[model samples]
Target: MSESAAPGALEQVRTFLNTWWVPNDTRAPEDRLPALLADPAAWQADLPAFAFPGREDAPGMAELRAALRAALGEARPVALGPWLARHPLRAELSADPDRPPLALVPEDGTAGGTILAAVAEAVRAGQWARLKACPDCSWVFYDHSRNGSRRWCVMNPGGSESRGCGSIAKVKAYRERRRITS
Candidate 1:
């Protein structure tokens, strides 16, 4: 709940979803596990509130990561009507023209509710295919590209970057094609 809560909501959701790499391979590194297992209290304290009020069963890191992975694995367009109906969202309409008034207040145990709302909001804003999980790294990212055709996570997405297997896989395909042609 910082000074920029409203505008920062979507970014906060994006940041939260990017927490773990839901490994696509057996050798997947645990970028999110060590810290979470090491210290639960501190980890929860560090989570972003986004634009929503907090709720009970706020979900441990593992659960939250699982939901994100599950959604990506479904690999389909978000149909938020049913999801929204399941959760009791507390929000108010806005009178201001330049601002969005969808402030979500969850009653309880709707840890994944924020994400669904964010997805709905993004889709409502015409960002139809924003969420993407890299097939190689298993890292989730928002596709900010104009055409929404981004297919891989960043090669280096902050400290201690992943091997960018998505890019590596592309190169492997190219090499195989050359071998066949040669």
Candidate 2:
């Protein structure tokens, strides 16, 4: 329960998806995902928060978050029935090897597997998108680019082309310049 402990497996997976794709201010280290999966209960108290900015009241989301946190903490993947009962997203996972495992895809897709597969393919072809955290929110996301030089969180409306931390410095410089001129 301590804040510094690693998150459980389900929480790790959820955190990876929620942060890696959508980008958030509260993402854990990328390596934490596999580590937590190897040991679900290795960290219980520090699991990432699952609440999205605009979807806190969505039906079943809270329960789903709790269930995923608990299940990933287990020694093994919990049965599908119980997991699905708490979160319908489990239904999107199929037995097809061609698809990505249910754990990888977002709910907006028909099946998580397909999206997962695409991510893998993109990664293998050296086409995997680079991601950067939001300077303000710390959200993670794939940076779609040929040169892969993106540095801002696309999910945030306020995100500027200038790097988050760098933008602050620019503002300070502008004010100092104006002060000297005046």
Per-residue lDDT over 51-74 for candidate 2, one digit per residue giving the tens place of the 0 to 100 score: 221233233333443343233222
Which ranges in model 2 have alpha carbons more than 4 Å from their true place? 1-122, 154-173, 176-182
The lDDT values for all models are 0.55, 0.37
Question: Model 1 scores what on Cα lDDT?
Answer: 0.55
At residue 101, give the lDDT of candidate 2.
50
Top of the candidates by TM-score: 1
TM-score of each candidate structure, all chains considered together: 0.63, 0.28
Per-prediction backbone clash count: 0, 10
